[model samples]
Structures are given as structure tokens and as C-alpha cells.
Target: MSAATARATIQAYYDAFNAGNAAGMLDRVTEDIEHRVNEGAIRHGRALFAEFCSHMGVSYREELRDMVIFVSEDGTRGAAEFVVHGEYLQTDPGLPEARGQRYVLPAGAFFDLKGDRISRVTTFYNLNDWIAQVST
Candidate 1:
């Protein structure tokens, strides 16, 4: 894939996310997608990703803003930086209790392309910052 096409693919994934179209976002990834989360375990497979989305939907509502996407010259890698504007709706196990706390966090994600789809997604953010915001 060319760099332009790779960038477009990543943009489409984020667009899907911003639209709250989880299925559309999943379509942009491979069946055996590898997901690496900051301060969390690495997980694999589209099914797991879907499950994660469901859980997140119940716990929080978020949107990405000020997104900047970058693609490798060879079009096999990409990265995106964005701000997450979100509300904590429900508490997850081992996390602070939620009462509709709002937070703004800067986050980034790195991607690995396989063919035309994303094979790997690794994301990072400041967990302590999030905890602090929601705890207050």
C-alpha cells in the first residue's frame, strides 16, 4: 500500500470510532488483531476486541479530538495522536467509582498494517492522570 492509502485506512478506523460504529472499526482490522493497551495486558483476536468495546461502552463514553495521523513511507506502519474527551459512566472492577466524571487526556496509538488491514494496535495514555481526574 502507498503511504496515502495507509493513512486513509487509519483515518477510516478512527472515523468509525468517532461515529460509535464499532463494527465498522472492526472491519478495518484483521481477524487475529493484536491489541496492546497501556498499563494493561496484550490481547488478540477480533472477538476480544469486540468484547472490550462492549465493556468500555458500559463504563465510559469517549471521543477523540485533534487527531494527527502519521504513516510510514513503506505504508506498513502508522501512528495517531489525539485527545480523549470522555465521561466515566460506570465503574469497572479495580477502578474508581464513577459518577459521570469527565476527563480530558492526550493519547497515542501505533499501528502495524497487514495487507490492507491493521494487524496490530498499541495504545498509550497516562493512567495516573485519568485516575486523578476521576478521583476528584
Candidate 2:
């Protein structure tokens, strides 16, 4: 894939997320996608990814804004930085209790592309900052 194509693929993934189309986002990934969550365990495959999306949907509502995407010359690696504007809709286990709290946080994700689909996704953010913001 060309660099432009890779950037488009990554951008489409975020667009899908912002549109609340989990399945559409998943469609852009490989079957054995490796997902490294922010301050959380690494998970593999599409099934687990789907479950994660479901859990997140129930616990929080989020959208990415101010996105900036980057792609390597080889088109095999990419990254994005964005701000997450979110609402804590319900309590997640082992986390602060939720009461529809709103928070904004800067976040980023690194991507490894195989052909056109994303094969690896590593996301990062300040978990403590999120806790502080929502805990108030």
C-alpha cells in the first residue's frame, strides 16, 4: 500500500469510531489483530476486540477530535494523535464510579499495517489524568 492509502485507512478507522460503527472499524483490521490498550492488557483477535468495544459502549461514550495522522514511507507503520472527548456513562470494574462525568484527554495510537488492514494497534493515554478528571 502507498503511504497515502495507509493514511486513509487509519483515518477511516478513526472515522468509524467517531461514527460509533464498531463493526466498520473492525472491518479495517485483520482477523488476528493485536490490540494493546492504554494501561491495560494486550489482547488479540477480532472476537476480543468486539467484546472490548461492547464493554466500552456500555460504560462510556467517546469521540476523537483534533486528529493528526502520520504514516511511514513504507506504508507499514502509522500513528495518530487526538483528543478524546468522552462521557462516563456507567461504572467500569476496578475504576472510579461513573455518574455521567465528562472528561477530555489527549490520546494516541500506533498502528502496524499488513497490506491495507491494520494488524497491530497500540494505544496510549494518561490513565491517571482520566481518573482524576472523572473522579471529581
Candidates in order: C-alpha RMSD to true structure: 0.7, 0.6
User: What's the CA error at residue 10 for candidate 2, in Å?
Assistant: 0.5
Q: lDDT per model, in order? A: 0.94, 0.95
Candidate 1 TM-score, C-alpha based: 0.98
lDDT of candidate 1 at residue 61, scale 0 to 100: 89
lDDT tens digits by residue: candidate 1, 4-122? 98999999999998888888899999999999999888889999999887888789989999999999999999999999999999998999999999999999999999888999999
Error of 2 at 37 (Å): 0.7
lDDT tens string, model 2, 1-136? 8999899999999999999889989999999999999879998999999899888888989999999999999999999999999999999999999999999999999999998999999999999999999989
In candidate 1, what residue range of length 10 has the lowest lDDT sum?
A: 49-58
Q: Could you say which candidate leads in lDDT? A: 2
TM-scores, all candidates, are 0.98, 0.98
